[model samples]
Target: DQQVKQNSPSLSVQEGRISILNCDYTNSMFDYFLWYKKYPAEGPTFLISISSIKDKNEDGRFTVFLNKSAKHLSLHIVPSQPGDSAVYFCAAGKYSGAGSYQLTFGKGTKLSVIP
Candidate 1:
């Protein structure tokens, strides 16, 4: 069972507030972790990623923290805006033979930004 789990299906936050989304995994072999943000009807776009070798990664308003010991990870958005409203998906993968990347994604967490 290669299921990545996002416990909360939805989250709401006021504009300029901080938003945090959580995810958990059962597989211990997963080495690469990625976060994607998606708008309605469109494919998810890569937001940020962190490897199992590191504990944290950040980009502008977004930061992702990983706790290997807990088999959990979270994405944090600072000063959330209306444009931040979208579904966030957490994915995990490891390099296999033939150089192909196979990803297992969470159900997704819908973030509603109230402006």
Candidate 2:
């Protein structure tokens, strides 16, 4: 079974409005989480991230919230713009015994920001 899951397949928001995307994970070992945005034919670009030690992290219009007790997380985009429309994916990373972390990504949620 997949460790990370994004329930909503897509979402639409008007420009200058708020866009919210949710994700869930079943792995208790995951100590870090990240949100990425991807455009068609291009690789995903890192957006924001939260560590197990922190409940939230924010950058500009992007914010990532983590709820360890619920094994869930969400991303918020405020004042959304048309350029923000893209496929967003949430990923979980667990520290392996070998000294590195392995990541598992959710299916993704396509967000459309209308003008």
Candidate 3:
């Protein structure tokens, strides 16, 4: 089963604090992992990604860590701002899939950044 799962449906953090989001997956064939941030009524925007061969990746205020052995991943946002409030989706897929890489996405985690 190519199931990506996000345990928390929602999280709230005060501005300037750290926000942590968790995700899990059951598929071993998934070689590429991605995290997307989505605003209301808009498509998800890619945040960070990590390959199965790597343990961690970072982008500015966002960081993603993957623990392949445990099938777990997490996204950390430091100094969270109100603009960071949005739904985050954790997705996984193989690189060689059909034409476009089909992403298996978690239900989604809503991050509420308080001012």
Candidate 2's displacement at residue 105, Å, is 0.2
Model 1 misses residue 67 by how many Å? 0.3
Q: lDDT tens string, model 3, 32-92?
A: 9999999999989999999899998988999999999899999999989999999999999
Which number leads on TM-score?
2
C-alpha RMSD (angstroms) for model 2: 0.8
- Clash number for every model? 0, 0, 0
Give a tens-digit lDDT track for model 2, residues 1-115.
9899999999999999999999999989999999999999999999999999999999999989899999999999998999999999999998887897788999999999999
Alpha-carbon lDDT, every model: 0.95, 0.95, 0.93
TM-scores for all predictions: 0.95, 0.97, 0.93
Model 1 bad stretches (over 4 Å): none
CA RMSD of all predictions = 1.1, 0.8, 1.5
Tens digit of per-residue lDDT, candidate 1, span 9-115: 99999999999999999988889899999999999999999999999999999999999999999999998999999999999997666987788999999999999
